[model samples]
Target: DFQTWQLAMYCRKAKLKLTMKSILEEYKCGKVRLVTMLEESDDPVVKTVKPSIKTGRKWKVAEAIDEAKECLRLKEVIGQTQTDRKGLGSSSVKWWSKTEGKEKRDMVIEEVRQREDVRRIQKAVQQPQQGQWTNWDSAMQRSLTWKDIWQMAPLRIRFLIRSVYDLLPSNANLVRWGKKDDPTCPLCHGRQTTEHVLSSCKVALSQGRYTWRHNRVLQELASVISTAKGQSNPPSPSFTIFTTEGGARKWCWRSNTASNQRKGLLDGCDDWEVSADLPEWDEHPEVIRRTTLKPDIVIHSPSTQQVIMVELTVPYESRMEQAHTYKKEKYLDLT
Candidate 1:
């Protein structure tokens, strides 16, 4: 019920093979390992044998073998298998009995094959994998795959993610493996680790790399939104996203406006409504306020005297909720 008992299975298989070999050795026979024979036939070890004639003729056929032969003769070459490798895992159920008469060997092979197959299936069905719960395992689950990770990230970024997950060659890992000098953070000169470099380094955060990357993504998105807003007929539901044939997917909307109009396949977006006359979106456009608080981006609809504000936060995965809370508190007055 817990696991496939590999050791027990191997032992049982070994016992069965030993018994089978002893029984067949009395008759000079062996079970061929089919896969091994095919894969390593050129090896100098595998041997082959052919069956010889024992009978000469049938009573009804007098002239059938007047010279020497009568019965159906097949020049079948049977592989002479090694008894040293005989096990329950043997690929061949058939045996080379070194006899022209195959009846006894065939019957033995058929019975053994059928019996072993049923036993193997029953054992397989009864085995299951079980593991003890660990404190380090994640409670929050997200179904992410390699495709999702690799799709938009650069090769360096992909390698970085792999290294992060595998804990490969980082100072912390090197130290764990007892092969390290200094494990100090490159930027902050603190105890260097995967966590420090990715999230906890004050020097890195102070350098504003997080904000810079966040802004770059937003800027590209904003540009695309602005361009899409200008297209005729607005956007509709059930829109399919298509990228330019020869460029990055992010640059999909950068094609000529005239060509987009001709195709009329792409839509402005799912969550956004865009029109030249509806409203205006401005980036950090001097929000007149009692306090110095300003949104990263703003949507101004003059007719309704309303402003929809936006704030972008690019925090480490562990700090998303904290970042969200801070942003919400910072913009409470606007809301």
Candidate 2:
């Protein structure tokens, strides 16, 4: 019985059936030979022969069920992997063989799992925590606002915000990517970061780029203001001074622009020396140490005895509201 059962298993595995017809065919016993000897006197002894093989329909049914199960399993693997029967990256492979289903399934499952792991890791890296941005100091100011940034042409400020400039290889990016031997800023020997590249680095500040940029605009504004004052031509902004007689001041610019322009654009009537009061923060190192109230673009008018305070800020477009509010509140009393 066990042998018969094992034979049925073999048949099922090979997609064959064991039955009387198959057994007869296997043994070459299906046909009986008719002897043609002269039979009047002697008849050959008849040999007993019979088709004895018999099998139930259950084996065939069982075979069908096994095949159906294999098909269902392959289908499930294909669905989970979102792969064709031929597999991924194989243009000429048209289909999979049932005999190697397990191997193919394992390969595709591993590929899908690896792909999912990479996707999850990427998502985690791309989106950072919302709290990291809170209470953030750009090393520039605590009062930075979006409106302040939009007050000027956006391209340069946006460049700073994006940190896209060609920088020294010592920066954080190259260091993190293992391209650089150091993560310290070459300019200041500080940790190189976006903030350091833009704002926090002392060496970058020492380059006088910030002052140069601010003064370029200031020179243009001074020229325009001079024109409005009916001094169609004025001295170089570096040393030019407007004298309107008043006890109070309206505006004053204190900068290092006085180095080289003394002989180029001086005017006979342009005053180079006048009394001015700077905002507390900018007055002097001594002033900042003494007072906390500070203003930007301070103006002193001796003729009217009045002080005009102006505040300027640069922030991203998104922080315009905060920038405006901070400056307005800071100067509300003077306004």
Candidate 3:
């Protein structure tokens, strides 16, 4: 029935007419539908038969109109579905598609493999070193305190220990090398080494003669012995010397009264005089004599008169000048 109406509409719109029976035969064979023919038809009869239009055997004219509306709605829904699916597609897919060839993809994969290999090698190398243990703890365990380390150290290590200890001390007097000031020993003009500066320096030794002489005087007075035999007694009048250089030396001495007097003055007298500290007299006493002076050593006299003084040009320029001026002024004042 729907096909019959469709054919009738088509023939009318084309300004041609065929029998209704032929149209009915076309409908039975499912050839056409009311909406299609209506859209195509221009005939007045077909337009007037719109109320009788049939879309299919199941749909009347009214139902066919509703079915047409449903078809349009389905088309709109399908169009919307296609748009949404386009939106959900991966952005990467579009970007990749724009690429000219497979060359870029292969390059990216190769770079990733190289990076992974490098990381794997690095991890393998680091693992062993990270797990390895150092002998630091065992070495530390062998010595308790730093002093113990120094005491037990061999000759080579002792020097290192001394240097380390000197640096750690609050009053350490380490020399700054390569300074503009003179580096020679002021007393003897010898090259200044640490030992020479502090202890064994010939200049210092010369300056210290008076002090050593005084100490000899005291040793005689005190009746101290250098060593005792068959008495199980340790040596007396023993001395320890630490040089600025990395060595220490010990000395023991015994003196008689005559030897004491020859070295300086009376053994027990507190009024012992040396070349550096002799008081001015109206006439120079024959008993008092000048001694050699050096400027790099402190001669400690441990006699009744214990004396300690530096035997060097003072290190600081400003202070040395000031001291020189003061001494000159004092001498003039005395004169």
Candidate 4:
């Protein structure tokens, strides 16, 4: 079983057919050496080929083809003539011409590939060992095709393949394999699974490790918003101040609140304020409401009287929906 699973992984990585399916395809295409020789020879020994038995390498090409057809779940249909159809039964299996068979072969193989992919995913979902990947379908919004994988770096490719399959030697795996006596995390003494080590360690959370990482991401985002705000030009005022000629000239600056020249949040405002609730960061927007909610980042346009609040979250893939629901509920009153 281990060897079979290893071979399947290699085939998946290379995007190639499994051994049995490849052999079946070769026979169908008339490329198998034994089948070719059998079709060409007229000797008594060659004519004595029998059906394959369960436990031996010595098998006829026809038997192998039959086994593969069964494994792939391709049903056989028998043809019946109009006069024979009334009597109700047909013994002869339907056969396609060479040209038509090639097209049908491609279609059937394509369908087999799709079904194989679905089965592989379902098996992964049912596996209790890899609990982190249970919500793979929902977590992955966009997946890389073969074209994208081929261009990635070797290190990135290796990491992607290993991480997805839970092949890395985490503490739990080490203990399971008898390499270690303890499976608890070194920092928090919790079960040292991949998710715990990566994101949920209580000691790491208290030590501000997670917060530091979150702040780093938030800082980059704030910089981008600040740059865009600076580059945008603000709209002109709706009205200008007028003064009568006297001994001294007088002018005043006034903003028209009920003017129709207002633009969007980003436009009509040269002074855009952006703040982030990060440690050691000085720019933080003061909360006017009676609440202690500090969003990760805040963008405010005083000219348009508009404000936007952003919250950052980095959770395990399986817990994404739960985290989103919690955030929405927590901020429900403020919104």
Quote each prediction's TM-score: 0.39, 0.28, 0.16, 0.55
lDDT of candidate 3 over 198-245, digit per residue (tens) = 444665566775456545444442232112111222223334444555
Candidate 4 — which residues are off by over 4 angstroms? 1-110, 141-157, 227-271, 279-282, 287-291
Per-residue C-alpha lDDT of model 2 across residues 193-294, encoded as one tens digit per residue: 664654557876789765555455555544454354344235335433455678454456655644533533323233322211322222422333355655
For model 3, the local distance difference test gives 0.36
In terms of lDDT, the best-performing candidate is 4
Consecutive 10-residue window with the lowest summed lDDT within model 1: 129-138
For residues 202-277, could you state the per-residue lDDT of candidate 1 as single tens digits?
A: 9878997665677775676666655654563543334345766775663223334434555432333223332211
Candidate 1 vs candidate 4: the TM-score winner is 4
Q: Give me the candidate number with maximum TM-score.
A: 4
Pairs of colliding residues, candidate 3 = 13-42, 13-43, 204-297, 295-311, 295-312, 296-311
lDDT of 4 by residue, 140-235 (tens): 433455676678897886555455545557799789778999998889888998777668899999998988887888889888887888876567
Query: Which 10 consecutive positions of candidate 4 have the poorest summed lDDT?
Result: 10-19
- The per-candidate count of clashes, in order, stands at 1, 24, 6, 0
In model 4, what are the clashing residue pairs, if there are any? none
What's the CA error at residue 15 for candidate 3, in Å? 99
Q: What would the TM-score be for candidate 1 when compared with the true structure?
A: 0.39
Model 1: lDDT equals: 0.43
Q: Which has the better lDDT: candidate 2, or candidate 3?
A: 2
